[model samples]
Target chain A: MVAPDYLQVLVLAAVAIALIIVTIEVVARIVRPHAPNPNKYETYECGERTIGSTGVKIGVQYYLYALVFIIFDVEAVMLFPWAVSFKEFDGVLGLGTIIFAEVFMFVGILLIGLVYAWKRGVLEWQEM
Target chain B: MVDLMNWAGIYDTIEGFLSGLGLSFIIPLTLYAIAALILFGFVAALVLVTTYLERKILSDIQVRLGPMETGGRRFHGILQPVADGIKLLQKEDIMPKNRDKLPYYLAPLVVFVPVFVIMGLIPLGFIPLDIASLNKNLLVAADLDIGILAILALAVIPTLGAVMAGWSSRNKFTTLAMLRSVAQGISYEIPFVLAALAVVLAAGSMNLSEIVKAQSGLWFIFLMPIGFIVFFMAALAEIHRIPFDVDEAENELVSGVIVEYSGMRFAFFYLAAYAELFIAAALITILFLGGWAGPVLPGVMWFFIKCFVIIYVIIWMRGTLPRVRIDQMLAVGWKVMLPLALLNLLITSSILML
Candidate 1:
């Protein structure tokens, strides 16, 4: 559970970050010189006329990798609460095997997903 | 003895001071606002120092004098970062003609805001003050029960900025960089949190302060060395620093997601990187190096000393190590680091069980 005061702290910190960025920008706007050339704002290409829009379709591999990652990522979060409370339950219930086995099962299944990712070469960084 | 380490006692001191002159009409929120501003200044100062240090350190490595002209050659360019800040501010806030302007503008803010939130959750060691006759007051902004998780949840928000900056730029490099960075961040996060979870298991609580307190006997680094390494590496990756900085591969991506930004917008991303580096160092100090736990010196000084050592190591890595390829980073994170983290957890739980 989060302390309510933390919310106030969070708000204050967020506002401060915004203020600092803005303050710096405002200060720079006052003191710095700015000159814009027609070519200066052009998207940089290595000394060649920019060709083709950047909106071209990218490989599906990035999305697929992200999808696999999210599944495993959520599983990691789920393990945290259990990890923190494991000692308490072990002390109270004295059923160490039950809790241990259950978590092992969960993690073991996840590890299999990881292995599958490896075996299928999903984790590999290859050009599509 | 009363606990000066709590936030409530500190608040009472502020309230008493506010009411002392019969100006008690100020709301409690205003006090928090003041604390928040102080923390902001602290983070800003850290970013400034770290940036200068990185430059100087890198220069030293390459046998060059970094920032010798700024703030006078006598001071060896100590004021160079300030000058650079001013220079960055004065530069044009460039927007590409084909850009999605809103996300383009918002990305930096999104990236920048989370640094402060993460800082607030970290305990930098307690300091005593006369107002409440405080004994053991925590230096952190909030001692939330979900302490580290709260930071983790907030920490995840910055990646959205990377994604936004990447997609909105409409540049092939920025978009590609964004995808790689986001993927790297996401993949690395599992190991990062799991390594942290190993600490949680050992400490038996998720509160950052409690974890620090638990380390009073023996530092977790001595107890869980593997967790330390995994966390350190994952954190390095999470911040997109050197070795793990493939997402912003300068040669391949030309500054990657931030390629299109200029002026203050670029500065925001740059500042965020430094701020995260500090937070990562602070987190490591708290979890492994016995935060504020030492002989003779005050907790705050010990905390800073320990944190700086870690920061120095991080900087050394930046200066020395070559950047890993994007695929190699993901592979190590998921394949090597993740498994090691889980094994550490297993080993930790078993030790605690006995």
Candidate 2:
């Protein structure tokens, strides 16, 4: 089956953007000066000679935050369908309250997780 | 309601004209080409105007004349952004030694493409003149069902590009900057989505145009002021604007994940930033400010008027506020904004139920 009109337009738009980027880059590559020097290739270090490896270990605190973010992000995703259909449910008897309560329990559990992270100092940024 | 000029009617007229010439087979292609051109031109113009406006506004705030030399003295450097674009196009492209060649080359494209795609999802304005046509919006490329969700989902891709740029650069500062940006981006995003969810709950639709239509009687800003504030603050952080721009703290990280890029690649990052800024402002206009809704003026005109006002406020904040510390930024996102967004959601849902 053929894709819907909007999807077709979206794909066409994406292609057009890719074409624009390519054309611009190609023109720039042709017109721009090309002189490569060793000094220019070196990483910028604010005038000081670079020392040590670039892959320095960061605080594990970031990873912990990422973990928490994943949980909340999922919660947000799950909440969208309910949020959209809420009006329909509200028009029906008894169903609106049930759906609202279910979402409340779901979000409440996630909020508890967030609070747990907060209490555990997982949200705190530890300076390295 | 006053009858506004209908883009959909014009589109159908064009399609019929083409069909009369026995060009019906190429109609879709032609329409798509036209849509792409209009969208690109609009976004490019927005970037140019906003860049110049930003400099002029910041300069005025600092009691200085900005961009008086470009274009002509009479135009007050109106052509400054154009000059900058041409200069960047002709600048030398630099690649650092021992960098990850693939991602280094691909990073800018990754950062840019999603922003362009998100532009397609925005309903610029509405004209109810074409009752027969599928879309009534002025010039939206795709009025998708999951409009806001698609926008939010696509918005996350650029952060990946930032991380890739930082990691591939083989530079300490870039890595640190990307990490900070990732932390900040993810932190702000929760409240942003939650705040937007409050709007969705109130409007009872995920489609952006419908959300705008829902605000016909009363704008969501009046109904949920806390949600608007939370969304706006979270949006500022998401775009890495000043006061929430710790990642690109020039005095510290030396231009953040983009430190090593030069020429057109560097230009891509700036273009993406401006495009995202426009999207944020437009989203605020659509979600909270009764998009395209006003007396007398056409919907498209009103939509843009609201957008520019919001954009001006953003620029004013940039001129006024200092960058918050990274810790403070995260604390605001998580501790303050997140709870407030949740509370807003709770209140909105309860009110709707009642």
Best by lDDT: 2
Tens-digit lDDT track of model 1 for B10-89: 66776678888777765455566767777777887888898898888888988888789888878898998898887887
Worst 10 residues of 1 chain B by lDDT: B1-10
User: DockQ of each candidate's interface versus the true one?
Assistant: 0.58, 0.65
TM-score of each predicted structure versus truth: 0.91, 0.93
Candidate 2: Cα lDDT at B208: 91
**Complex DockQ, candidate 1:** 0.58
The alpha-carbon lDDT assigned to residue B66 of candidate 2 equals 91
List the candidate 2 regions with Cα displacement exceeding 4 Å: B1-27, B127-137
Residue B257, model 2, lDDT: 98
Note the residue pairs that clash in candidate 2: none
TM-score of chain A of each: 0.81, 0.85
lDDT of each: 0.81, 0.86
Clashing pairs in 1: B4-B136, B4-B137, B5-B136, B5-B137, B5-B138
